[model samples]
Target chain A: MRSILNITDLSLEELDQLIATAEDMIADPKKYSEVCRGKKLATLFFEPSTRTRLSFEAAMLELGGSVLGFSEASSSSAAKGESVADTTRVVGCYADIIAMRHPKEGAPVVAARKAGVPVINAGDGGHNHPTQTLADLLTIWRNRHTFEGLTIGMCGDLKFGRTVHSLVGAMARYAGVKFVFISPEELKIPQYVITDELEPRNIPYKEVTTMEEVMPELDVLYMTRVQGERFFNEADYIRLRDTYILTPEKLTTAKEDLIIMHPLPRVNEISVKVDDDPRACYFQQVLNGKFMRAALIMKLLEVNV
Target chain B: MIIGQIKDGIVLDHITAGRGMDIYKILELDKLDCTVALIERAVSPKMGRKDIIKIDQAMDIDFDVLGYIDPGITVNTIRDGEVVERRQMALPERVVGVLKCKNPRCITSVEQELTQEFKLTDRKNQVYRCIYCDHKASK
Candidate 1:
């Protein structure tokens, strides 16, 4: 009935229900395809994100529902001088459920307020991206069977990584989960994340400049690329270009069972040689994303689990 | 050692020395055409060393921006050689218009028509973040 503004909006009880429902969908896919046969999903992506937009579409299609809307703002009326409220008011007429992605931080919050139906935040500007965090949780649960008692090494650009921030916030809610942040000083995790979430929760963590030192101890290695265009000086980007590269040589020291995940469209951060290895679960993570979305769509649409 | 008697004006004391230019830029003091006395290196017990700006005819001063930039400032509202309202600088709740967000792709910055709004979160450190963009305030 309300908007999916942030991951915190979903209570722990609801999270459990979603997890159970997703697990049910995973076990039996065909049993609930026609559950929401006539509903509609409208994806309003103001930015370019082929993977997430595709996953949302696939999720809707798998439920025997339909998908409508634009992957970019140019194709939509937003290229005009229309406000977010006006756009959502228009989109609300056609959509049964709205999933919006915007470059502005609170654009979805504004959209959700105007939307006639449920609004899911696909991504927001350097802010919370709840659904991706959902997929991440689902992926972790599916593989490891639990969220706690693990050291997750989030390497690369932690300062600008929205997914990493959301994941850190979500994991702090669990028990016995420690974090090993591997990033150069220029791209270290923001101070607010440590002060507001990790330290306050009494969650133990270590900040390291290199990945190789902590690679063996990590249960999961979540990689995100350093955004070069954000740097005011090109030299700063050059200085920390290869602070973390998931090459096979580095993995020789890592545990055989250590799972690797990336919010994809990866650059040279992940070497191609690691793709052939079974532990490289980024593509599998993508598949898992679709399943997670399918399960999410069904539950959100009031389809039977 | 500079001295001026205030008949009807506000004397903003305890500002950071050499930060008067930034404050002037932020408030657009010259455009407003108010009589001002810009003082630097004023000595006070609280600030040991400070600066002050006296606006002769400014009806409304944004104490919020003053506090946000530097909490050490003291504001004195005077009328007829009598101090009307005087207090230390306090954090502003809602800053109506301020600097643009650091994010170039942000809706506020790109949209052009929308005025930027920022909430003052950290008062002591003067951390102001845009409400819509979540971009850090750029000095």
Candidate 2:
């Protein structure tokens, strides 16, 4: 069975198809409303998540499917020391598909190996989050209509932001996609990402400390929160928390056609006033997330038409 | 000078000097009932100095571990005190249950039952990343 453990799980053709399907879903939501009827989705979240968990639940619910499973580890068999493989094996018997978010990296991979049903990694501890990338792709497609020759600026906490990593990996596959990585020295994008993903592929990229210098040239400005939860040292987190806040003044230098994005539940990385700007596409990105997820469920379930 | 000769066994030769003890511990040579000899800092024209291990029993050895520790190792099989098969070692594509992934968030770190696995992603750089978390295995 096919499962999305990472963004690379979907090929370029598949990604294009998914994006097209998402656009279709947005155009006629009622047509695909009952596509997943009589199906079941199990959300096995072993970590605290608001947007991702709710996004999955909402996507499944809107598709005429039932949703089950816990939102945290304490409420599940995991609290009793049950393994991810064991938990997924049991959940597989009950659900048609599984969306799992765990604190442990590659927990979904463990589940995917054991579970009879298809497993979608919701977010596996600072690892891949393919669905969010799908949403991001759809948002980018809706705005720019193409991935070619686009300057994508990713700002703040590139090291710990799994979204940035996944997005970089996905976008690097496209033609003429340039990246401007803006982050503090301590939070620069991982070296393997540069060496394995970019350097070998010969993708052009520039790493900088400030976002404002490259803001005007970008087609998409992805703002990520500098999360304290991901930091081991509290003092380091406090020092870098406000390193790249996207204020109204900064947006003035950005292109008029620039699309500002954030994987919401954002904490001060993006100023609240930026929400009113015509370029702010994050809310639209959230809606696209639902659409993309619905399309993804259809694709994974092999629901025809 | 010949330290010892094995009738029917395996010989690990050309191990980088000072790494013989590491290989000994890794291969658990101490647990073997058969005779095992470790020659450390042996003079070598090519390597300047090298380590060699002669096992008196032909047993299953982990070539991947040998490859990971030092790809320069050469293996020789002895049959009736005659060197029959000679093998050169290179880095394995994937290693299982050898080096533990150091990433705290890696699933292998938490899942005690899971065997730590790493894939040699970059052969040129000798970079091995945890198969589960993509955390680079520090040499």
Candidate 3:
């Protein structure tokens, strides 16, 4: 069975089709509500998640499917020393599909290997969150109309942000896509991403310390939270956390059509005042997540709607 | 000075100098009942000085593990004191259960049954990343 363990697992054609399907779901929600009727979705969230977990649960509910499984590891068989493979194997027996979120990277990959049903990596520790990429893609597709010839600016902690990593890997596949990586020297996008994904693909990209330097050129500004927990030194985190805060002043320098995005649960990185701006699409991104997830679940389960 | 020739076994030749012990330890050569000789700092025309491992027993060897550890290694099969087969080794496209992924958050670390698998992502840079977590294997 096919599993979306990484964003790159989906070809550009499949991504386009998924995005199109998501748009269709948004256009006519009532028609697709019963697409996944009688299907069982197992949401195995081994990590605490508000938006991602709820989005998966909401997607299944909206699709007329039943949702089962845990919101955290402590409540599941995992707390009793059950392995991910065993848990997925057992859950697969009951559920038609599985959406897993884990603190450990590759936990969903392990689940996918043993699972009888299709496994979706909801979020894994600083590794990958392919569905989030799909949501981001859908959001971008709705706003920008196309992925090509766009300057996507990724700000804040690029190094540890799995969303940024997955998004970059996804967007790089499109033609004429340029990246502006804005981060502190310590938190710059990993070299492997440049070497493995961009360089070989010949995607033009520039690295800058300040967001202001690249704001005007960006078509899409992807913002990520710089958590104190990700830093070795508390002082460094404190110093960098405020470095790229997207204030009203910063938004003025950006393009009028620039799409401001954040993988939310925001902590001061994006000012709440910026939420009122017409360009801020993070909230819409959350809704798009539900639709895209519905599309993903339908596609994975082979439900034609 | 030439070492004792093996009658029928396998010979790991042209290992980078000082890496024989690492390869030996990794392969657990000492546990084998047959004679296993590690010749460290052996003279090499191409490499100047290299290591060689001569196992005096025919057994299936993990070439991927050998290739991962040292890509420049040459494996030779000895049949009746004659070198019947000689093959040069290169890094394996994928390695399983050989090198442990150091990433604490990798699934292999938490799930004991999961094999520590890595794929050679960058051959020019000699970069191997864990297949599950994509954590680069440290040299």
Candidate 4:
């Protein structure tokens, strides 16, 4: 009867339950693999996202459930003028659970209103991507083995990065979490997020132009890429872009136990040279995403597989 | 300028003055064959200048249509030339079909037959965005 529209929709209790389930799945994958054997997950991605789409499909498939629905918007009935409400209603008939990723802000809200089954917002523009937040939560929990009293540095493209927003919202719920926002002036984290989520909650945070200054003090370094097209001033973009590139030299400044994560499809943001570090957890984050998603699919559908 | 009122009909008041014409055209008050009188720039302290729409027939207006008319207007029901029920009709929490989404690339904006829906996110900002395209319809 409920939908995963935003991170706030999941209460602290529900989030704890989801995180616990994800940890259980991660601990023993085979034991939970067949919990959704008879079910189906309909992924209606209005915006084409190969990684997120594949993650949802992989989660469902590994759970022994089948995947259906369109990866691209044009491939679906949405191309021929079908509203999200109508599409969800129609797709809900064929699938047990629905996951939608739209370029629009509230497309999933429309889907949730009319969907006969549970709806999950895979990603909806720069507005929200709650499931990714779930993955990040599980990853941070598993890597650090705790959620509190960490200097979390969110570096690069914080302005329009929905992942950063979701993460900030999620982490703000935890105790003694300080945030260091590292980004170029133009790509500084949106004020709405800072004022609305951080300042009001009295979560201590500071803005920094360089990662090295805060990198040494950080326990978690979450990196994001700066797409060339996102910036109107090409010169500023080029200048600051190189500064955020994580090389092996950067790790010398970071704590040995520091966990680095990127919501992948990264382009030169974190050099491949840094991937060898034991603290690099982006790949592990990907696997954790699958486990978290599998946990979500099973829980939402009330299936064991 | 004495403009008459309608009995047992809806009177939309405090319309930020000149927007009454836009609402007349948007609601297509002419086609309804309802006796409609539009007054612009009538002085008032609340709206400074106000526009009032007196509809002869009692018909439930789409809240989206009401908001599209003017973000500031309050829809009031009239009976026997007296105010019976008056409430500011909000651009509902969720809008089905009223205004065209401005984004050319959005699926809803491109589809000619689609019923455009916009979930009003920033109520205080008076921001009503397209659910299909994330486009804001600004006046």
What is the fraction of true interface contacts found in candidate 2? Answer: 0.83
By DockQ, the better pick of 2 and 4 is 2
**TM-score of chain A, predicted model 2, versus the true chain A, to 2 decimals:** 0.98
- Categorize the docking of model 3: high
| lDDT accuracy of residue A282 in candidate 3 | 97
* Candidate 1 lDDT, A91-187, residue by residue in tens: 9999889988997777886787688788888888777788888888887887888888989999999987888998898888999999999998889
Q: What is the TM-score of each candidate against the true structure?
A: 0.78, 0.96, 0.95, 0.78
Which candidate ranks first by DockQ, i.e. highest? 3
DockQ of all models, two decimals each: 0.28, 0.77, 0.83, 0.20
Off by over 4 Å in 2: none
Worst 10 residues of 1 chain B by lDDT: B105-114
Residue lDDT tens for model 4, A1-305? 67787887777787788888887877778887777878889999988889999999999998888999888989998888778888999998999999999987667877887888999989877768888888898888887778889889999989767799889988998889999999988788987677657876799999999898887899999999776654557897787666678889978978999999998879899999999999999998888888888878777887653
In model 3, which regions exceed 4 Å deviation? A228-236
Q: In angstroms, how far off is A267's CA in candidate 2?
A: 1.4
lDDT of each residue in B14-70, candidate 4, tens digit only? 887778888888778888876888878889887678988888889878777677556
Predicted chain A of candidate 1: TM-score = 0.95
